[model samples]
Target: MNDAHHRDADAPLRMTDAQHREMRNAQHRETQRAVSGFRGDIEGLRGLAVLLVLVFHAGVPAVSGGFVGVDVFFVISGFLITGLIVREVRTTGRLSLARFYARRARRLLPAAAVVLAAVAALTVAALPPIRWSGVAGDLAASALYAVNWRLADQAVDYMASEQASSPVQHFWSLAVEEQFYLVWPLVLLALVWWHRRTGWSLDRTLLAGLAIVALPSLVWSVSLTQVEPGRAYFVSTTRAWELAIGAALAIGAVRLSRLPRAAMVWAGWLGVFAIVVAALAYGSSTLFPGYAALLPTVGAALVIMAGLAGRGRNAAGTGGAAGYGRGVGRFLSVAPMRAVGALSYSLYLWHWPLLVAAEAAWGALSVVEGILVVSLSFVPAWLTYRLVESPVRRSGRLVAVPRRALLMGAACTAAGVAGAVVVHAAVPPPPQVTASAGSRPATQALAETSKRPTAKPPPQDEPTSITLDPLKAREDKGPIYRPQCHQDQPSAELQFCAYGDLGSDKVMVLAGDSHAAQWQPALAAIATRHGWRLETYTKSACGFFDVEVGVGEPAVPYPACTAWNAKLLQRLTGPDRPDLVVTSSDTNYQVVRGGSILDPQASRPAYVSGLRRSWQAVRAAGVPLVVIRNTPRVNIDVPDCLSAHPRDLAACAVPRERAMAMSTDDQIRAAEGLAGVDLVDLTDDVCPAPRCAPVIGTMIVWRDAHHITATYARSLAPRLDRAMAQAIGGRTSSTAE
Candidate 1:
């Protein structure tokens, strides 16, 4: 392996055989040609794709679908790889599928393994202990190019935020491409052999591929987009058609030479515009690849088509319309774009996490700020390209002695797998057991009876029952219970949320996800206030999606949540409905809705359709739905803010305008329409005046980048008091009845 591939301290050089293998693997590395037709333009297009992805990710309002740059890259890869393999088949008569894949493994496995190892280490250090377990599992899945399945399993949780923002998220695209590389080559080889053996020429062989393989893939792409947009967006099987589109272009390049230079320019420009526009306009709502995705995919196809070929005579081979396509071809041929294209693999690998890390290191970077960080991220990419990517890729050592590179590649892959094992071993989750036939935990749980407890609301003596009436006179007993009772805070304000002295008369129901669990302290205060008890029915990601109360975690239903919900549902219908369902999830849960961010819609229809089913389950259980419209979903990450600003509250506050921007008045108003449901007025409660602070009354209310900190939920007692008291109905009068 060239001097660059030598193992560094982070990557220990163990076996000499492995090192020799690493060096030798370089020969099989298939190098992409420097802009074959209009090299400059393709480089420009690659830059355009990368830029679109960058701006889109940086919260640029315009480039919503810019992320599809990855798909664009996929298509480009397909075209390029197809051309290479077909050329080999034509020249050599027999295509070596093993050699093609080995080259791919050599090219991809090293950098990917290195990056995966880094991400794994960072994940273990940064992610919560509980999260490391899955992070570990994901690591292993990613190594095998099956991470898409892991993500799909997690996505079943309607409330799961696309925490795919994990350092490893980019790996999904790699996985898709890797999977495609594995199968497409063999399929082509088989076809090429059959046709050539029968004396067919290259043109006819390619046409057959276009007719049989590429065409079917394109058709499936459209169909998959409709039925399973999310899967279609991420899954390789669904995305293969896009690559095939490019592959077809490569196969037919010779035929496209007749196009005018002017037309080529227009087509190429239009392709750029399409990708740019799609990136800028697509947002959390676009159904993706369904029909909407056609914009960028076709735009990319046009670029490939523009470069397809040109008759070099009058227009050369660029055709009559080759104006700037040739010029674009020339411009992209410039040194910078080509260099970037040369190192595009490394640049793509390192850019995201580096930018993300920068964003994390110092709050969200502005447009200019993001640009600077992106510029800086290239340093590492350049260094790696110069040090690792270049030498190893060009080296013929691997071709001379195949075992060295093979073993080295295996070791690199093993490191990733081993890291995955470490994450798993360090923090193991419950043992995995397959779910019963075809029944998803969410689906089965959603279908189960809605449990409304018949138990009376927790006794009035409970602190969760104390009333807070802004309109009422002040009582010196200070609302009966103290906020921050969970921990010592000499000055922390105290307020009551639950009331009534219960001798098995009332039940204090805690609902929602981990946000609800954080209030164990506050809930305990109320339970302690009354001669009552505390019960647990917690689900980690069950964000009150009534039907799928607990989902996507274990194949087995969350028996605990169901058991408690049943009891709670009985009480509500019979006489017990939660004096208060102290739920804390934002009604607007976010999801990766097909390469775009999607927030829950608040319109009556959106709400009714999205939530009524769950609400019905709740109401049917005979309990009043004490709906807690989610706490302010702060775009300003809380932990990040804390680390950035310790004592100065000003730094931690989300600016007034921005805070107002996130508030969903429509959602709250809709919840208010439910007379039986007590809407906890949080819009006003969470934000006092100038702004909503990430930490209020010294309680770090906002948690992580998205959720509220558990410590912060304890401080909401005062805000919850009046509404909770009404729900509990005056049971919280004494500490001991």
Candidate 2:
């Protein structure tokens, strides 16, 4: 163990036990050869990779492929860590798991904890109460090095994906790296033990074992990227192969040392070109960490291998290429590249949160804003690298005592958790306001509301001060939510629930996305009054339009949504068709026609055409359809906006024109002239004129940017009920009353 620390790069192994000396000595020399062959160019690669990721995240154009930098990082980590483990095992004759993990913790935790604490403080100062829960959750996950899985779950979740990015979202890559650090040592230890017991070549044994691990992981990655790309992007199972690629190179370092100088030079430059091209050309449309990842990972491997070949002992054969080494290594070892590389880890951690905070405080970061934010991150990154990461990592006392290192890690984790708790506690809860029946009469509310009024409407006076709570607004979902009858975006199965009088013969079926689900409270109120059986079939982000939907930024086809729609349409037009099929959707999609995508404006015609098709199916089933126009979509999360700027509720109000522009105007136009389709627009009740206020009738108007609060939705029951009655021509029992 002592020899493991003090041995020179070219030193031969010192053996104590005579029986194992030859085997151990040979192994040690091989490790020394690999370590002695280190090059500064690798650190330059780190600088380049980190810069690409930082700029890409900062929204730099033409760097859409910058995300591939993470693949480069995975390869680097695998190579360095694998080399260290092999060296230690060769010298000490045993793997010290405790020392390995403790070293990793010491190297990574202190700076991370400081950054997490800072982010927490910043979040409390700038972000709204509604965002605290998510940020807190991310902080905890980051502390535990499980943020990758947490983010994977969130990526597939409809509500979570819509949320603003958390300051610590960048921790997911670190989490993946940390998880590998934990498991890889154990695997290496096992392989060493097997090699000794079976008398097999160490490199050959490791190569076979890693191949077993990497191949299956690569297969899973390829398939999942096609199936659930969002989750696959973060999950460790899909990313294990990239790390394996680097480990394989480390095992073959002995052979890599023999490449010619010219070959090394060409390969090194080609590797840099591959990474640069990937960063410049790739965009959000690319399915990554799959086959596409090979370009960057292979490029990174080539660079590392070339660097190794240039430094090996043989000027001709045993390994040595000073001219090739000087060409790449000298350039990379320059002051600026070396300095950026030294601060890369801390910079990667700090840059993302600052960008997120900047965006959250204002709106999207302009190119100039992004540039300034990236520049400012260097200050903290340098400070953290010097003040926190350096001192603790180099401390001999902590390095010698594995237990002490672990204790320090525990302390850092505790600090991160405490920071998260403090941030979470700062968020104010929703105000408790009991609805008073006499405050606003159900009958007179509609009479006072004018149709198509152009002036800014007054807020409802049901209980003005306690209109909505930011915390509760998120939880204030409809009846269909509790039982999960309203399926999430990823679910393909059709789920149905009866909310009203189940025994009643007069059935009303409600269907669409969460926007349609939001109206359930109001519809249920009407259903109970008239003893009508209300059947709800809703899916998140799955609108009723008979068109393909996209999931993320580049708009990948949502297979689950397509499957759900097919199943739902079959059920809706089957023998159990209701007396009236009521549908509403927050239409947020670009139209897909004959495999070509049309933008939001051009897609209106296609949206209307899809609606006509649905109307025809329902009409053919001998059922009347009442289409509820979707409510206004505010530009910001009303609850969050109100919470952040509580003293100025007026600031939370969006102009009615802007809000209406976000509505399903295309779908409404499509419904025109269709037989058996009755359009019931209640936009006036929800928005009521020139502007849409955050609060109505002492109830919060919106839960998020798009969905309305259940309390507010219930408040609109009287108006919605009236519209349904008029649209159905008083067909139900309660209409005449």
Candidate 3:
């Protein structure tokens, strides 16, 4: 009936029945070993991948590009999983989707659930109340294997970008793998079904399918990485090609198995070299999962292929390179490597949350401290591996029944989701603040002509009760925070919003970057009281200067910002120009010139020239310009500090000299001799000489490190109105009753 019986049917007639039965059993065992035997070399490769990632995350200076290790892991997973599927389909002529999923569930879900539950508890203890709801949401998404999409959406969100990293953010990689597992099998099954119906070669059909799915993803990855690198990093579509390379290797493994031992050994070491080189050469500035990802992914494929070739030689009794313990494989199959590989999955899960918790407790950890925190995670990792992962994966009952394993996986997921829901429910709502009408103290309202003011006596101790809830501070961004009012990257088209006294004949325009946008509440209130129509034109990280600006870490040329500035200047100088154009921008933008980004000190002169050029354009058009000096930055997240230290508010205050130094006031220098451009200095009103209080007159001054809260900005309306009136030659308009 089978190969073993068929081969011995005629030749073994002389042998006894018992001896014939024993020979068949021995051959069957050998066949099973060929299909599913363990590879110690692969285990060692896993150890190497995890070690690279951990060391990089722990701030090891040598492995700047160590993040490439994730690409290696992707390749390894694709090869092993694809090989298993191919062997099953080749042996049985049909794939059992249920059994495949059951095996995956038994191997992954138990460990993941334990880590999620532990992170949820850690969130309650270490993270501030402001972060609890978000972490709970992240936990639920991780359980559903959809956190990657959630993070992808957050990548483009302006406000979300500033929030603290979630402890469970590492789950994004696991989500991508699980999503692949869900779809890859169905695709293979469809190809198998077609093969059965048409008598087509299954291998060729599978290769064609893989090519169709993977090539476009590779092209898209390259294109998207250039335009939207943040979103590109987290999305599944951009990363699929890396896994496909490994799957392609699996499909060709049989043909490649006969390669010479010397060739295999060379390839094995070369692959290791490539992986190590990428780890050392790459850094946070590297654009990832694009063409750059090929180095590590192909390197991993080579290592796996070489290991397979060695095993093939051993099975054939050629004795040249009998096993993985040859060349690089020997190094990989050593005991230390195998042990780390065995615990790699649990270690990966446990390390990230501990690192995040440590950073949250103490501002930022040194390299040694980070390494110590990661090292401490081994205890929980080992416990989870021993108590949960091993027992469930080896459970005889679950293995005997696929349905029971699937049920257990479902139960584990539900428990994780349920725990997240409880944490979400337990988080208290943000406290409410009651607003009251009040007048500003005379000394606090510094005018445009005022001299440099002396340090004021320390304000009475921080109010017992804050007027705005610290939890609600982040959402206190002004009316112009919407997409229609403030444009993001990738769009060069001009977009503006009109508010306050829309029917008034007098016109005023507010224009610049987010620092300019933050003043909208006060300016809008002033416009409403004085009966002037106000139009706002602002873009995130894009200033209203005639300078080539570079943005983001390891800054790249911002062409969109250039285009937006051109369009905005054209509108301001056109026939429908407003009577007054008020502008402000963050002073920290790097200048791009001759294809290079200049350092901060080098960028100052370019900024001054650019500001003068913009101001000259408005003046030539017969429109007056008002430049609000950029506000002082706290250089620390005010809301997070407030939430962490509510009672001892002094701990959140930034020193006066340090805070004021953040405002370089290049605008002041540009406007020195420029006619009809009024410069309004509001630094004294925001920060007195001695120190800048986090809470001023019961109002939270800053919503984040830089942007002022809309509530505080609104309270400054009366002072801003007085300053603007004096700057614009005291135009007459009735104030609102």
Local accuracy of candidate 3 as per-residue lDDT tens digits, 1-737: 68889778856675767687678545533443352467777889998999898898899999998888788889888888887888788767678888999999999999999999888888888877777888999999999999999998887675677778899998999898999899998998898888878877777888888999899999998887765677788899998888888888777666566578688888999999999999999886777768888898889988887776744434633212225555687788878888888898999999999998899889878999989987888898889899999999999999999999999999989988987997798776654433233633232342222346433332312443344467788789988987588887667889889888999989899999989999999989988887888999998888899999886654667889999999999999998999889999888889999978788899999989998999999999999999999999888878887776655556777777787778776878999999999998888777653556777667778898888999888877776787877888886342432
- Per-model CA lDDT versus the true structure: 0.56, 0.79, 0.81
Residue 202's lDDT in candidate 1: 54
Better of 1 and 3 by lDDT: 3
Q: List the residue pairs that clash in candidate 3.
A: 65-282
Show where candidate 2 strays beyond 4 Å: 1-31, 34-38, 314-330, 430-457, 460-464, 591-604, 733-737
lDDT of 1 by residue, 1-737 (tens): 55556545335646666787556433212221212334445666676677667666666666667787877887788777887786676456677765676677668887777777776776656553435655677788888888876665455433244342555666788888888787887888777767758877656776686678656666776775554455556666566777777787777665565567678867876886787777877765555565666688788888877664353232323322333435345555556666667777877777776665665456557877777766776787788777776666666986555566677677877989999898777763322223235433321122132232211121110112122121111111122124422111111121113433444555656555444555555555666655544443344443444332212211112334434345434543455355435544444334322333333442224433434444556666655556555555567545444433333435555644566556455445545445555555545545543455544332444545445443444445544554556654654442221
For each candidate in turn, the TM-score is 0.63, 0.89, 0.89
Task: Please report, as a residue range, the 10-residue window in candidate 2 with the lowest summed lDDT.
Answer: 315-324
Candidate 1 has an lDDT of 0.56
User: How does residue 122 of candidate 3 score in lDDT?
Assistant: 88
The clash count for each model shown is: 94, 4, 1
In TM-score terms, candidate 1 sits at: 0.63
